[model samples]
Target: MSEVQVVRGEMQPWTDRTSPRPALAALLTDVVPANRRTLILGPHAPQLIESVLAHSADVTILVRSVADAQQLGEDFGPCLQVIAGALDGLQTPPYDVVIASDGLDRVLGYDSADLSWSERLAAVAALAAPDAVVVLGLENEFSLLNLLDSRPAAERHGDDEWRPLHDDPSRPVSVEQLRTALPWTAEVYADFASRTYVRADVAANARPGEFPTRLAVAALEQTDVPLLSPAHEGVDTAARAGLLGSIPTGWLAVIGAQPSHDIYTETADTVLTADQNLTGWDTTISGEPVPATELSFDPGVVPATVSAGVSVESVLFRLASAEDVPGFRKLAADLGDWVTESRVVLRWDDVVYDGESFAHGVSGWVTEEPVEKEDLLAAAWVRFHERLVGQHRRHPWPPWMLGDDLVSAWLGMSGVEAPEQTPATSPDTPPATSEQVARGKEIARALDEVLGTATGTVDVRTALAEAEAAKHELFELKGHVYGLERTLGFRNKAMKTRENRIRELRGQLQKVTAAHERIRGSRTYAVSRVIFHAAQVRKPKVVARKISRKIDRKIRKR
Candidate 1:
């Protein structure tokens, strides 16, 4: 078993937990010399160490963390020589191949001398032989990630960032500066988590239809954190401005000997390498070459053929941003025709179009499931609609036309009627299952969040406008309710007045009936009734005269 050598004071409890980078490991496989003395500086992934060991028999690793050193000793056994100390205390022979891709920040111990970034770089360079191949990484302080980072300044720095030395004057900021700082012929790459690397020169010269720009955009999009703005916009803007290479998250410099490929990227555990030709890329898994056409990243999801062409998403964005309805409609119709003919489904950003035909981009994603033409068209437009709205891209559609309505209009332009239920799901479009609809919504929401306008998340102005509208509606409702109450109160008072008049009339009729009954029941009233009947029979004229007089008296009283 290999033994740990403590050269000076060591950081006992620390261990670098940086994720392993398969793309970086694959790159190392090309540059590391066969059967030569190699020195790996700082904390690197086990996969990288294994890659270096595959090419070299004698390997030495220098780490400031004693825990990491001991773990390496146990993992590699006699194949590796582990040194635990600061970079200043290491005393070793010149190595034919030197790797410090983790950078110089974490290599300093608590008891070590305070060294600037340049001084530490010089110290690492001193350990390299005259003809050695050196692979070094330098983190960019002004990276696009740093610029878009939404975290506060204090939260961004952690325990490992105790001595970042980001303000050192002699430190290089760009790929060109890094190249000039190195002694040997250097090839630098814009490193994005070591999962993807783009040649600096290639990225700097990338156009809208090129592979480097697409790769840069894709790499920048592979983040799970909240950012101040979308990284893809920044990348695209920089690429268009011919300044993409100027804002790398980090730069990986290879000295003395360059790697065989211009770019290295790992997706779905498969490492893909591409040259400057940009025509195609080769994929490998577990050191064995995999047929590019058959490579699948997910179950039932096949990868599209890699080619060079104009990104459909970029074209759509341009048309929308310019508010060119005719141009956008034409493109949509053409795109719909292609999808109908090809029977393939891919994201707009993943699909590309040449002058003659549509093809998939170099790293395009595709699914194998057969989808209806209307569903496919609706899916495409839905995604486009989300991006256009979420990013606040100007379009010819009315401002009130948003979400599904906007998508439906866009679909209509392609001559496909949107489903009455929803753009994503409709009984007419039976091919789009419930699961598919849900997934599509999920993807749309995720895209919205990435664009910094999530579902139900409105801007301050929109929120205020909605609030004002609600307030106005409430006020109108309150006024209508008050009017109804007033009407009800008037009706109630009129009914009460009629009831009092009816009660008074009933009381008067009751009193009149009671007086007549009492007079009839009395002896005088009986006799008077008998006499009036006799008079009606014997003296009809006299009875008529008495009745007329009584009627006159009653009329006078009224």
Candidate 2:
């Protein structure tokens, strides 16, 4: 093996308070497996360091600051090998994994005068063994959220170093560019709100209006919702509603000799869109496909049993009543035929259920062609509407009053079409009659009344500003309360000390008073007093007479 090159620089010491963003931490922990030799580039996030230390062995970190090296050295002791210097000449052995989570662009890209992004990445890659994996977190320059919000929303830049070169922010390096730069097969994962990563495979299956910008709209409007979890805001709802298909917020690139473990795990039953586009059952998860089993309920208008070798549309199984079978099947077939004739190109993959033996039933069909976003949903709705109408005719109820399931399925499929940008109107419109004109006027008046009652005005920008000010005030009050609490604690301790001292002095005073009383009652003190009075003898007789009287009185009393 050749000696490794070490690059040293007089870099500024690490000073900014930094911790791992949850998404970055998740990316690192997912890519770098346990008990493997790992090298962390830059000391941006301490949490990432701690995670590597806990999960891997013989951890080596390449940092640029002496202060950072000393701090990290003291933190991990002999367990970590902290190297403080430039990246151009680092002499180290190739390891199993190399992680450049935060400030990758700065650490090796522009922060170093000697290296470009390509050179920086190469230097880091040199430390990785042939089979070693490299994981990097990068900013998406054309991030949809940033574009939509007209602000910097992506977690791409760090405070450790300023870029030496200025580049167009609008023209970020494409995924293809990244793939070409790094050695080995590179897989990029787009980070969703910096919480979870959405794979590009799943993203390729997206439909219109469900792209990253539109999905982020819900999250941005409801700003209080946290970005760390996809469940917050409307991300989970949007994912279930089929919005994120083609783009993601940011990227985490994994490069190595071959394909490594996926950062995310998806199940077979997962739904990626509202129109049954990209269901989990359609793709093999973790390299294994879920097997099809016999559905128990009678498939009303569909197949009774799906054969193992033959492929069909995605299936949703449920138990249904026997009475509703014939009508449901007839409607489904009519819809399937109509949809096929209309160029929607779908096959009714059949609903199969065994009412006599089993309880489970299945609904949904396979499509013969790629799902077109426009027509498939309308065809499904027409079929559902016809089925609902037929059921209503028999039950003496309205179409909307049919079985809840039938109504819901119809509504869900009906909503797939994006609303028109402009109201439909014809240039050669027919003139209205007097009666029609009067009715229109009355309707307009009613609408105006409704609008007047329903609407209230708000200055959105002003409200947001006020809310922010209130938040800052709340934090200030919290600081003041914390200080008051500390002062109270100190005063209480002082009061306790003073009380203890007072108790000690009281005990000493009590001891001194007892001693004074003992001394005054002694026989020596009484005899000395008598002798002194006798020596003063001008009135010795009188003094003697007084003493004798007192002695006689004491003897009588005894």
Worst 10 residues of 2 by lDDT: 310-319
Return the TM-score for each candidate structure.
0.76, 0.41
lDDT of each: 0.74, 0.48
Task: Estimate the TM-score for candidate 2.
Answer: 0.41
List, residue by residue over 252-339, the lDDT tens digit for candidate 1: 9898777888788876566777765445433333333332332223412333335566678888888888888899899988887777
In candidate 1, residue 76 scores what lDDT? 95
Q: RMSD of each candidate?
A: 8.6, 27.3
